[model samples]
Target: MAEITASAVKELRERSGAGMMDCKKALTETGGDLEAASDWLRSKGLAAAAKKSSRTAAEGLVGVAVAGTKGVAIEVNSQTDFVAKNEIFQGFVREVTGIALEKGDDIDALKASPMAQGGTVEEVLTANIATIGENQVLRRAKAVSVSQGAVIPYVHNAAAPGLGKIGVLVALESDAGVDVLEPLGKQIAMHVAAAFPLALDENGLDQDTLERERAIATEKAAESGKPADIIAKMVEGTVRKFAKENSLLNQLFVMDGKTPVSEVVAKAAKDAGATIKLTDYVRFQLGEGIEKEESDFAAEVAATAGLTK
Candidate 1:
């Protein structure tokens, strides 16, 4: 039997949102495998599906820039939120976002690209770290563009003009003019920020995610003592529901809370007397997927003083 450590229990609790004892027991039952423990909790109806986005604790800003029909979103991480507020840090993020808009979102390529001021993007970042006196990273960038329509950008909880905690870009392919596209695109971008859709459509949902949802649903259905065919149908329905809830096009619009996003776009196109298609979108939330270590200040201080915690 594998030993389940306190840190393992803490991690399982964070991942599954189960109680301490429940998480500990799940870890024990699953031989201390974090992923398996999560499944165990979900199967027992002790926890909801884990959402990676909720784990965000890193301090940073997500910057956005746009040119005609093209937009880019970038994330720059810092060791502390105080650093994220610094003018120097924000300026670097904004400038690098512009470079990404021009070049592309490849991390290495963007880092290697020359900055408008002087040195390469990576060099500027290094200089900023020394000047700001905190460690930082050029985490990631994503670009979205359309052949003809408007690409709109929005920042949520903005720290500056184009820098914020969440950056979103919506690419619309249509014959509609900016007068029609800009407002609509911005609304959709805001939706992307608030809704946090996993993908643009059903086809874009990850297979692994779907399988995991299916497994949970199967375990849940089996608990009802239903027949095999009924259990299978129940599992399929649950998976389909999960897809509809997480897919951008299928999700109900946050604005109206009733109309599907696809319907919203279609209605806007009808009103504009033109064709509108949502081609692509980029939603960058700062620190998403990067786990920040949780520290106990009291415990550390006690240990440093050579006292028992």
Candidate 2:
């Protein structure tokens, strides 16, 4: 049996939000496998539906660029928060965001495309590393465009002109006047940044995600010892609720926290004197799922000084 350390138990507790003893037990039952232990805890109804609480990602920048009727938001991540303040790194991110706006949503294509200053995007990134003196990367980019209405961009914690740590792009598609929809779209984009909805609608969400939610809901409903007919209804209701909460259009607006986003769009349309639709939105929070390596300061110092234990 794998030894369940205190740190492991603590990590499990933090991830699953279960009691310490329960976390320890889950770790023991799963032989120290974190993901399996989480699933074990959930199977016993000891944990929440979400798998684990990811580490706080507070170290990156959000970038936004608006061009004509389209807007792009890009997130570039570095190992340390200090790199975010570096002018060279910030400039690269801002330039790349503009490139993203021009190139659209294909990350690989964007990487291959030419940058404004000189070489290809990849070449410029290589040069940036030499200049910035830190390992930098173009993490992810997303673009939102509208044929008629407006695509508004929002950057939270901006480090430069159109670059920050959390970027959001909202596309409002309508024949409405830009004067009316621009502010509303920007507000909605900010809401998207805060809420981080899974998708625009149920159809946009991945099949695997839907299946996972369904499985969890079905399992929870089955444990009630209710009739199959009642359980089916309960599961369906739970699924619909899940979709409403996770889907962007169905989600309650974070700003007001009362009206659904769909209703907010409709109200904006009425005020703008045209039919408006929230065609799409893109939000990119830097280093969201990436885990950086934790370093031991004392060990590093010792190694640097060439001390032998």
Candidate 3:
């Protein structure tokens, strides 16, 4: 059996959200294999879908860029939040975002694309990690574009130009000039930041999400002592309400708090005397789903000193 180290157990605990002893046992049982240990925890129902298996659990910036009718959002992660404020780190994020605009959002392509400073993006990132004295990763990049309209980018409480905790891009396809579309796009982006819509429209929402909602509604409706037919109607109505609330187009505008987003777009088109369609959007909130490890310093000291068993 391979010896399990403290750092290995700590990592496993963070990844699986399991107890310390459970993590140590899993690592020991798996001979210090992270993946197999995660599998072991999952088999024992300690985690949900190997939460930390391929996810980046770090702090950094979600940088966004918009040019013409295209926009891109990229997540660059660092081991500590301090690196987010570093000049070199911010510069890398800005350059990578611009490169993403030109080279497109395919991460591999963006990494291989030229950098104004020196070598490829991947090379610069590697150099930064060494110089910055911390681990970092270019986690994800995505782009949205329209044929003949404007792509607007918004950074909530922006730390700098296009970098912030939450970055949003709204793609509007319209015959209206940018002068008119830009404000609309910005407002839509703001709404997205607040509403946190799951999809741009009902069709865009995945079946799995709808199914989960349906299951929850079914359980709730069963407690009402309602008949079979009425219970069915209750579940259907509940799901429809969920779809309307969670889908961007059907969701009420956050500004007015009443008008559906689709209606808002229609009204904008009527006022501008040009067709306006909210085609797509992207919202990246930094470290949104990744769980961070919160340490108990006192407990750690005691454990280190073998004062607690």
Candidate 4:
């Protein structure tokens, strides 16, 4: 048998558009022959994922898990909604989410981490793609933690126990017991799902987003055609209002539509006899950014049939 170097496997993977692990296995099976490995991948349909990779994967589940004071959320995307109903796919997501609780918010680290069942997460993901016959991607993940209080997890309209279209995790740092923290954290997580605040606070909001808001405020202020300093004040006032409305802590509570989230936390703490600080949170809506392919079914079927006939 020929020795298969890392570069050899990489070359094969690049040529065949198969997964890294699949390319290595193919090379090993074919005695380190690149052409033969590519052929093997094609024959096994493992290369199909690459062919489908260009298509949008906008349908899938968001999985969330909480272990003690730490919580993590993951978004696993597939090209079709059918994949979301697959038991194998759901199981894979659940395992990955469990791994994520330990892996934190770093996507690369989470993908490289070892799975409980077997192999690295990347290896398992490749295997799942080959078996499940869909181009599935572990898109993104986030983690929120509290030093003393609860990191509560919530799934909105869950398809499975901890898997759903929306997942939210809220971290409450407090001297409060689990009994006091759990319900409070859950209410906050629920609010996160509904409100979809851009960030926990103003500072947490991205610079680009802030700039965009400022630009809008300036444009609107310019339309008023007021004095220069007056326009500047208008912009500032608009931006301050924008910040408060978009920030999680400053947003009015969805449950009551009057009290701000920060005040609600304070009230919860006062009622519970503890100091509860809303520390951090993460919210994932499945396929939040991906663009899906849209086409006419009849046209697609007719095109697939025969143009020569």
**lDDT tens digits by residue: candidate 4, 105-161:** 789998899987888887777777778887888899988887787889999989999
lDDT of 1 by residue, 1-309 (tens): 999999999988877766577688888899999999988877765554232223333788999999998999999888789987798888888889888999999999998899888978876775565466566788888998888998999999999999999999999999999999999999999999999999999999999999999999999999999999999999999999999999999999999899999999999999999999998999999889888878788987998799963
lDDT of 4 at 60: 84
lDDT tens readout by residue for model 3, 44-94: 654542332233347889999988889999999876788899999999999
What lDDT score belongs to each candidate, Candidate 1 first? 0.87, 0.79, 0.87, 0.88
User: Which candidate do you rate higher for TM-score, 1 or 3?
Assistant: 1
Error of 2 at 71 (Å): 1.5
TM-score of each: 0.78, 0.75, 0.78, 0.92
User: What CA RMSD would you report for each candidate?
Assistant: 15.3, 16.2, 10.1, 2.3
Q: What's the lDDT for residue 308 in model 1? A: 67
Model 4: per-residue Cα lDDT at residue 140: 95
lDDT of 1: 0.87
lDDT of 1 at 215: 98
What ranking emerges by TM-score with the best candidate at the front? 4, 1, 3, 2
lDDT preference between candidates 1 and 4, better one: 4
Instruction: For model 4, give the RMSD to the true fold.
Output: 2.3
